[model samples]
Target: MTQTVGKRPAEDMTQVKLNVKWGKETYNDVEVDVSQPPLVFKSQLFALTGVPPDRQKVMIKGALLKDDEWGKSAPKEGMTIMLMGSAEAVPVEAPKNIPKFVEDLPEAEQEHLETKRFGAGLHNLGNTCYMNSTLQCMFAVQPLREALYKKASGAGGDPTGRLVTAIAELFKDLESGGAPFPPYAFLVALRAKFPQFAQQTQGVFAQQDAEECWTNVMYAMREKVKDEDGNPVVDKLFGMRTRLRLKSDESAEEFTEDGMTYTLKVNIEEKTAHVSEGVALGLKEERERSSVAMGRTVVFRGGTSLTALPPFLTLQMMRFFFRRDNGQKAKILKKIPFSLEFDAFEFCSDELKKELEAPRVAYKEAQDREIEAKKLAKKGPGPSAVATASAASGTLTAANAVADVDMKEAAVASTSAPTTSSSTKLSMTGKYELVGVVTHKGRTADSGHYVAWVKQSSDGTWVCFDDDKITVRTEEEVLQLSGGGDWHMAYLLLYRAIMVDMSGAVPAAVSEAAQPAAAMETEGGSSA
Candidate 1:
């Protein structure tokens, strides 16, 4: 039989006789279609030799038959076609028998760690990295953690509440160190709440804005959870207090300040290229027609200032912009330096500057004591042996001790808070340190890997949480995340204010609990 695809293979040969050998079996007087493609012989050989066409490797004398070749492929009467491959499919035996379940495993093989803290990786369901990365980043936030774990039934299986519940369930799975948990439930709930997310990009995968997803989930979570007194937990933790100042131009009788700051918009196109500079530049005066200050349509220049800073400050680097040609949110590959510590005093109004003074002095003293303690420890115990150790300011926002000098340089009032004999007043806070950073690895928000650089509260260690693969990172690595290429670029920066609590307020043993038990015991024994 000839299986000719359009044309025959060769002119001189047709229906030739042959002897075929596949394994131990030998088929005599086999007919070969030499005029057709050489592969067609495999089919005839399969009928007599019992070897399948795919399994049969036909060879005449020393030369093997190539597929679709006729004259080139050795074929003749009385030819003993030797087959090298097997007639039957070989059984694939696995090297080791794997146990299906943990319980089925041998006692020695079973892992029983007392506490297995899993650095959980999120399985990217299509292109849902934006949600995964954003969620992972915000998961470190104390308030969000509390709300998620203790989520109450609001809207009762409704889209918003379900989303919250799904997130809580996800956290539970992530806490365990076994498998990569897919965000299926949460995604389903997300699509329900916001149908726009269901809209796919890349022919079956949905690409979403990580920041937008973060905001939406936050909004829904905030809506779902509230305090007994009806105070929203999200608002208490993440809400910032902003006050704006404005000035009116000539021909305006009612010279009022411009409208208040409602939005957090930071542009990165700066002269010096710093996040602080971009934020400062964002506060520069802009023209706007005011109702009170401009009945005559006079020039209005307004500036925004933060009166009360939040416990956690979120600073978004304006790195992505719309590219008209590609119709995509293209990333700006500009290097913007990021600092661990942040100070908003320069961005605040002159009137508010007075409030930060007293805390500034106390924080500086605390820092000085810390430096003194370190120095004393190196020099063997002296008068500085009793130097107070600075503990993280608990609950209250504590300004960075280093930024305290900024206040003195600005010529702010040098007033100190009245300290009691028993304890110190540690209420001043404005300086912030990097808590977490949400970064992007690709050129656009719609198509890229999103990751989080989270700082450990127990120790000031920065960890890069890329999906589920968490790795300990250095301070230098975190600083280098400021954009410039195809690598991970810092997109969202979360800063936590340095908090300070005095030793007198907390018991020495309780205060030093984080220290090694032996060290704490030795210090106590020495003191006694």
Candidate 2:
């Protein structure tokens, strides 16, 4: 008891709205104006679905039915439309009344039938029909056809056929259920037609091939070493039987081994080898020493010729021999061994050893000269001292002496004085003289303020002094003073006299001069 609403054949359906759920998370509401007769709706459907309009599915849909005017009045409330098309029902041609049997068919014909059945099943199930189409096309071609021919003739097919069949059957089942094809299978079919996809797959395979190549090379090299019985030698015995000795022109005493007496040398340039009697005995003794070192038994089969050895092996042997000969010296030197084409082994000779120690000898000599200079400086004044003949004739002025004493007291009160906690008590004194007037007070009585001056002495020492500290005498007093013209020089003279007198009062034993003359010279130089 169902009623169907059919389309109105002659009425024009101008506007139709289609609600489409396009893939996951996407929906579209499309309005189509189909004012013209014979309107094609597949392109419009794809436009509504957001699928490419020119894609195969849209083309196939269009081919199925170019126009279906009967769909005009179809109930449009979420009703699905089925495009009108003829089913793939080919006319069954009579085979001239011949009887049919599955086993009687030719092998090729039987295979074709089997493939068609599988392809049809895949199409019904909405499986990867595009991929199935490709396979059918491949089977129709040479190699694949031959392969199928062999398989049908009982020549046996590879496991790949079974995989392909199973994939086709799964797609067929999904199509039958009206479900969309799986994205992965759809992609596989799409990529087969796209060259970039093949390149990506090939790239992955290429990386695996490279890794396999390296692994094979390592295994082949490791297998090359074998024992006399043709079995691979144990890891412990591999490379254990080889020994190399270096023979140099130097004397046997110049090189020695810890537990062996052998001394052998090789002249690399001349390709000559030499062995000393001690070296011969040492080679025999090395067997026992090596056995002890390895904590196992070792037999010395007499040394063999290494003339055709590789350069790498030769260089390794040279380093081994060098270390055995002078391990301690080599460690101290931390030398890097190189080819004779570069520098010679100059660091290993006796001459080089002496040259290395020469610096220490020179250092000791310089230290002795320093000690001698210190001894000389410690001796105060030598015996031949000249006497001042008129020393008592010159009278010391009390005023000048008092001024000098006051200046000395002022200097002692300053923080610049040296401490006497140590044995050496250093005292520094200098004579300062005013050379230029940078600022001067005016001659007015109220302008008798302090003025600054630059001063220099015969030895070129200059100092600035405040003239306010000096006593200003009247013109009559200045006339009485014979040396008043250079008032700054007089002040400096008084200062030096005060320092000299004070020096006399301090104990001579505690003086810096009590130390060596070298110490006094150093103290004087530092004070300046």
Candidate 3:
């Protein structure tokens, strides 16, 4: 006759009421409706209704229960109610023969239990009394005084006893971490480990053998004193003595074991020392010869056999010599040999002679050209029509025409002149009275506002195109025409002028009547 609220079975629905008391305050008795059958009837009554049937409660509702017991159980109108579902109790199978601690672990993790068991056994063994006893027995030994006394008394003993003593001492020192060991500790260890090694030294007394031993010991000591990578700790402290040879006519050169010819002068007074000047001269000559023969300077200060000179000294010498040379100051070669036969002296003398002769040669060539130009100028106007036209122009004086002719000849001479195998060209052109022109590649317009051409007057005065306007009234400024911005054109023309002027050839001429007086005046002025 009873009907369930839904499709669930009737045993799945239950109603209960809970009477909660907190501290001294008692809450109202509340009905908790649930939807599950009980596992045990008595237990279900206590659990669902939160009241033991055996306990006496103040509230009693049997009359209301009869009104709605066959349907939904409803509490009195003023009372509160809570609804809950009672699900079937899940089964909890007891684990079989498993350790209490391993109940929560998975099967795979449980396998590690055996390993843990073994480790615990080992740990127990380590802490046992027997292990402590064994360690103490191994470390215990006779007192050092007793052992030494027994050994001095010639008591029979093992030779290794000394090793044990030494090892014990080493261990004590290691424990204390005190003073450093002696350098001979390695040798002591080696001798102790291999006693027979010392026997090999007996009956060998040759000087060469002694030297070899010394060398080996030195080398080994050097290695010991070196850093991890084997470079010396102090470079200057570990250098080898070397000899250099210097020749009378050659430069100073380092002597090597390899059979290379060198010109080193040995100082007779000092058997081990070499004359640095002689050595330097020999090396210089050798370098020059080699460079000339090879057509290029050969660098000799580097490679496997040579080390670089100290930078400070090299730099200082470079600065000193270069400044002296450029400044044309007298240089005192203090350390250099002074003998006339010395190669360095001869080289210096030859250089000086050439320098002295250069100006004179240049002067003679210039005089010759000037004489020729003057003769041409005296010819008045040439029979050529261009000469006539030039003569007709008011600008052409007899000296001017002569200067123009000389300039043309000089230009032709420059173009036809033989040159070295360098990629350079030269051109010289000027008349006796006119200025000489040398042109080269001009710079790009963006480079700066400077002309690239240079002009030299008949009198050896030279001015750049940009400045020529102030120097020469009739000088024309030529703009750069090339699009490539190659400055080689200007360079070539300048190079030609330099070559001709250095050759002392005058590209223009002045009247002979004007030459003597001018030269005398210049000489007098110079003398004054």
Q: How well does candidate 2 match the true structure in TM-score terms?
A: 0.13
lDDT of 1 by residue, 1-528 (tens): 221112224563656667766677777766554555554456455434546555667676577667667555656667777887765677998668765776775553344221124236676666777887887777766545645676554546666887788788777766664444556566656766877776654335457777788778878877887655455556545555555556665643332342322224567783647888888877766665646534556666666776544445677777788989989888887988879888767876555567665555555766665566566667774554534322423312232221222111111112222222123222334566777888888877677788888876656667776664667789999999987778898888887544333334331211211211111011000110
- Candidate-wise lDDT, in order: 0.59, 0.25, 0.25
Leading candidate by lDDT: 1
TM-score of decoy 3: 0.14
Residue 178 displacement (Å), model 3: 99
Q: How many backbone clashes does candidate 2 have?
A: 19
User: Which 10-residue window of candidate 3 scores lowest in summed lDDT?
Assistant: 310-319
Give the distance in Å from residue 76's predicted Cα in candidate 3 to where it truly belongs: 99
Each model's TM-score?
0.65, 0.13, 0.14
Model 2 residue 53 lDDT score:
27
The candidates, ranked best first by TM-score, are 1, 3, 2
Measured over all alpha carbons after superposition, the RMSD of each candidate to the real structure, in angstroms, is 18.5, 47.8, 46.2
**How many pairs collide in each candidate, listed in order?**
5, 19, 29
- By lDDT, the better pick of 2 and 3 is 3
